[model samples]
Target: MALYDHLGAHPEDRDGVAGTRFAVWAPNAESVSVICDGNGWNPGSDELWGSSSGVWEGFIPGFGPGDRYKYAIRSRSGELLEKSDPFAFYAQHPPHTASVCWNLSGHRWEDAAWIDHRRDTDWLKAPVSVYEVHLGSWKRPKDGRRYFSYAELAEALCNHCEQYGFTHLELMPITEFPFDGSWGYQATGYFAPTSRFGTPDDFMAFVDVCHQRGIGVIIDWVPAHFPTDAHSLARFDGTCLYEHADPRQGYHPDWNTLIFNYGRDEVRRFLTASARFWIEKYHIDGLRVDAVASMLYLDYSRKAGEWVPNKYGGRENLEAIDFLKELNVELHRDFPGVLTIAEESTSWGGVSHPTYNGGLGFSLKWDMGWMNDTLRYFEREPLYRSYHQGELTFRSVYQFSENYMLPLSHDEVVHGKGSLLNKMPGDVWQKFANLRLLYAHQWLNPGKKLLFMGCELAQWTEWNHDAQLDWALEGQPYHDGVRRFLGDLNRLYKTHAALHATDCDPKGYVWISGDDAARSVLAFMRRTADHSRNLLCAFNFTPVPRPNYHLGVPVAGYYKEVLNSDADIYEGGNVGNQGGVYSEEIPSHGHKHSVEISLPPLGAVVFDALTGQAIPPRPAKAIEAKALPSNDSKRPR
Candidate 1:
């Protein structure tokens, strides 16, 4: 059937070495030669033995592992093409210096064999909290000299993410981008991890550490385009080897790069195989497909004759979409627990929908519009900018994505936008309060979340990868307080069953409204554990305090304020609110099924409803009763 099923590189066993033969389906090539390091510093020994197919094979001793190589391709004109580094894992300082054939069986995988939850449906039930990082930038030096080894970074970063209570780790593309500051978006090699980091094995060690700590890793994968670097997949064999010759298929105008021709069979194989290679080889938990919207529309970044399209001449690029669907389907089928997250911002249907529903099979899509809307609202001064409308404008578009992450990404903090904390327009107290509002609202929203590196500590300045975060500021009262607040927030999120339980199920949440603009207060309840469980979330955004602010509860019982962002111990003004318990009985609509509670001023609180007895979230009932199914669909927000 397929050569990939049997293809592998091995030199230990003589019989296996005999089975190892080179094959390249270059239909137009007049001649080809295989280069080998086995030959003693000579030029002619690289010549390969001609095979039945367009492939060339030979039995050369000591030229198997860690040997740099490429195919010397000859065109019909007898002209030699200065080709790309074919087996190029380490396209480093000098470029195309060497490449070693990947040995699959060498790695010692210690991952838990029993853990295999499918990534697509996994987010449907589990609470999703993502930590987005650029492996290089997140921990680079202040002097712009040292880059942490992948191993060192792995140890520190994964532990930090685990401590932060995030479920997923989304890395910016680490597929060997040519330029460092382009932030891994400009990829040159899709199959290999960046040599700038540690070795391929070293990268695997990072993933291994992540698995041990129960964190899922997702990389920013670019199937949309490639960098314009010379020693790359483009023009490899004196022609468009991995790309297309025609302008219709090869150019990326916005980024000045080479785009893949997905319609071509070999091109599809290259991309799809690259996807599987990461999931299977590195054991990456997911892939966040970058610039999906650019890939979807042919008119993207258009400049008249410089672009071309499919036969139908519609705005759509059907080939890319077709390949995307196939690739996602194949990924899920093979790995099951691997996620395919799309970074698409269009109204393209089924983005976060199931594959069976005639949609692209992305497990989740970034809720960018919601982020922009909510952040803009947060930036408005005095907590008064179309106050009532700002209350839940973000919520409308938010509920669309089946699974979404509320991201405070690097994009927002760059180019004079400032940090999320710096985006606030008030004094120190007001700033902290604003930060509280942003985070509390995010926690209450019906989605998972992603926070950039320094946002947790409320880093005042905008982000710059050229240096480490202002870690020295931890000694300052404001910074230390913010750190405590963040750490506590994580504890609160995981401890409460309602906050993250049954994320996709509507029954897990309800709106207990005090929806008033003048009062500038809104209350919602997250109900995930059981009817006996409730988390009363109330936010007071107005400068003026609401006296005797009464909020209705969904369940009829005692409720205790378990956490408060405006607590006096946390450097917040004591004038706002004091939280204990609401023991008062409520009579509303002639039904005694709900309780009344007091609201806080410029404060956010989460209260747990008290059951008569300690209520177990999902306790086993009598065996005679019909067995209730366990909740397996964890909807990552």
Candidate 2:
């Protein structure tokens, strides 16, 4: 059970008296009292008795549910402080910081079937494509600036997820935060679901609806640091109870937040309990831990002379590392199907490996390098891309270092960074083409996929926390084409075994032609664990079609063109190998057989080789053998 159940306000019957039991931890306080609506918010009216362990307990008759409360403590140093309960399950909608007492039991959950399936499922081999969303901005009430309630968001969000064939929905933090601009990153209530949308039960119903629709929910959890709001956990008991006393260690430079004292037993327990509470209470499928790189290092954003080194004279924060390992161990041990993903940007070794093998024990880590390099490559003009071919191929060196999730997340489109569609360097037509190619590349690559909400719609503007997405663009032909392409890509990714089976294994990916830089083309083959099914992916980076482009394949039968980013349905030039091509016995790129293809301009084509089966060709026009001139005579064959 979580600490919230033991501490804070809970409904209880003591000696036949129906009342609420209040327990709080204020180790350094001289006196503690529950200041609530029943007591007219007076500190001395309902005083609590203290124990040796620093906990104070009391029972207030008739103060059970729907009461607003705060803990008033007189510090040992003769100072008084009023703070919200850190273990609060629901808080007053912010701008008012009182913790609300509410009963968390008796809400029925209908996700038993989903829970059972999750436990027996091996997620490593599963097709995990997450659609990252900011609930407030995903959609809003049409009448005005008022937000959509959780119940409304549940049906709308899940419907969109099902339409796009997304396997999971990764929510950008919905925890309680005072400032709307912070986008819930500076969370005040760790255990409480933000009341900005609705009540705690409303949020629970939102999650329930997702599970009913077969979409897993992943919340972005921020345990890295907290906002220094006065009413929050900043200086409870008029002392640095949750944070460190020293500014050099506790204060965060970048975000102006306070770091938690992970070394302290109570603090560790509080953080871990918060993590467990969400999984146990809300039935969340996974937790994508935010700013993990900041937690792992003591000098993350500080100068060498300004930071304090660890006891071992190293930059690594040992306590935080231990806390992470323990958190992962406990969560995985207790919740069999729950996932813990890290947004770690550094080259940290073994981030997703097992804890028993001297690793951090996370299920997955975000592939920041892949995201950066791929974006950098796509942002360059096609004429200059040949010189930067390494940008596209560099991931092969460290792709299998961790169980990676390739995320084109919201971070990339905020704070002056343009949206994904606007980041491409090209004319209007080529821009949409480049965006389609980017999505195809992400899906065809060997990793799990995560796309921020508006990228699929090809929205031109950057993400704004206060404003909703450009829903009007969905009706535009070009914008609708991108959305259609994404939906098809997602469906193909989920159904194809070769695309997701060995996403984390090296044996699943093989390079067919990675050095065709003159035309800025890339070709790779994705295979199943037993090599039973194979997918040959080819990309033409420039807006120049290449006909009679022979791609190497392991099999000799017909290879079906499963997906084409340049198809007319996707608002492209429609250049491609008609439907399927027969492989010839000409050895190319060290393969026994090869197929000639019409590679589209700034497009991606995926060919599925149905091995050991007779594949009848679909009706289509025959592709003419008109090969484009290559700078390298020794190009693949």
Candidate 3:
């Protein structure tokens, strides 16, 4: 019965006197009191009575919503402590920490149609091109305002996302955190939206607008660990009540924080309640759980002698695994279409599989392997790329093992790691072309797509959390070209069923020419589930063009060039097949039919076969490459 009731401050009529009822968990506290603005911060005047269940409860007459408060607890060790409410719906803006009383029930939602449609939608088969955003730095005011309010952000962000053809917006954590530098990863108030943006209602309005604009929202959620702030969950009630007792299991070495004690039922319930609160009250579409690898492994970032083994003598954190499985199960059970994505980096099997099958139950997991290898492959000089072709083709070998989201996230462009455009190995002209090629490959690949905010505008510098993106670059031709290219790519991805419907199925993809490593080229075909439509894609990694490059096809037909990254509109060299090419009965790369067309340098071209007919092979010179690699530079078959 207690679990069904609100846990924090709530307005109620107590004996016909309107006041706020406050409840907090402090099992080890000798005495507890609510200190609020209405009570003039007097603790003794608003004392709370404790129950056998470990919750302290009290009612303060004349104190209602909009009042600010904190819990003053006298621990068993004779020490007094003041801490903010963990279940607070809103918090004071950082640099000043206090819980603000907020009622979560009153806001009017105008997205019922979006919510209703999502409940019955099949997200796995849907196009999910995501625009990952960090609210603080996405855009800042020109008139000296440091940050936009939630209402202001809703209009700006939704307009940008809608114009860019992004299906979803994956926001960096908005949960209450102390430091802006940590980017909300080190959360303190699990149930409150950061007041840095606006009130709880304002955040709700932001979400409502996202839904109204048909853009799904997936927020980064950090349940793995929290900062050791004096006013936070750390050492609450003069003990490690929310975290583990032993430092080996409780402390996070990498972040210098305290990890949640998943083994404790109270802590588990608290975290689960936070998850449910966001979904049920705030109407979030998904949770992209952060740093899951740190939670999954007991020995993560620790020396062999420094870490403790589990009861089974393994590195796996059993309690954390159980908690994650339960979290996914509950979320999926309650919200049918809501996604739970994992940022698990290790080769942890079954990260996205069902818990019933002895696997972690997440809807999707970021493919860290693909991101690393793909970036490494692209960052290398084109001459040296032939030796590392495995990095390009290696992903297809295991792409279908689990549900994946290819994330070019904020993590890739921070801490001296340059921006995505800067990561390419080339001059200014080739740089934009290479980035377009990268994005083209990413979208056409067999997975959902997620690109960090500034990538679309080809921002050359790494992300700065304190400053806004280079919005002025949008007027530049090269940057504007990249932006236009991304929009077109997104539109194409959304319009084609072959691109997304069977993203997780191996049957949807086939290799066309993966062995042309000598020329630094890759060709593949993406097909619909029923083989009704096929989109052929080809990429050239080097800066050298290959004119009349023969690419084999399963069927002979007129292949129309639907997309060319090298087109003049994209600020490229504009070297490509005119509009379409005809396939002849040329046995190449084990295919009976093939097309001979000019492949542009540092570009990606996609084609759709519009007609089919039996034809004979053209002359060798017509079908063969205009130039082949030197004899010593051999390509694998």
Q: Per-candidate TM vs. native? A: 0.86, 0.96, 0.95
Give the local distance difference test score of model 3. Answer: 0.90
lDDT of 2 by residue, 129-241 (tens): 99999988988878756899999999998899999999999998988999988888999999999998999889999999999889999999999999999889998888899
Using lDDT as the measure, name the better of candidate 1 and candidate 2.
Answer: 2
- Highest lDDT, which number? 2
Candidate 1, 289: how far from true, in Å? 1.3
Could you report the Cα RMSD, in angstroms, for every candidate shown? Answer: 11.3, 6.7, 7.6
Over 4 Å off, model 3: 1-4, 611-637
Worst 10 residues of 3 by lDDT: 610-619
Alpha carbon deviation, residue 370, candidate 3 (Å): 0.6
* lDDT per residue (tens digit) for residues 159-265 in model 1: 78766677778888888766767788887766678877767888888888888777778888998988767556666646776676776667876788888888888
State model 2's lDDT.
0.92
Clashes of each: 14, 0, 0
Residue 528, model 2, lDDT: 91
In order, the Cα lDDT scores of the candidates are 0.69, 0.92, 0.90
Evaluation by TM-score, superior candidate among 1 and 3: 3
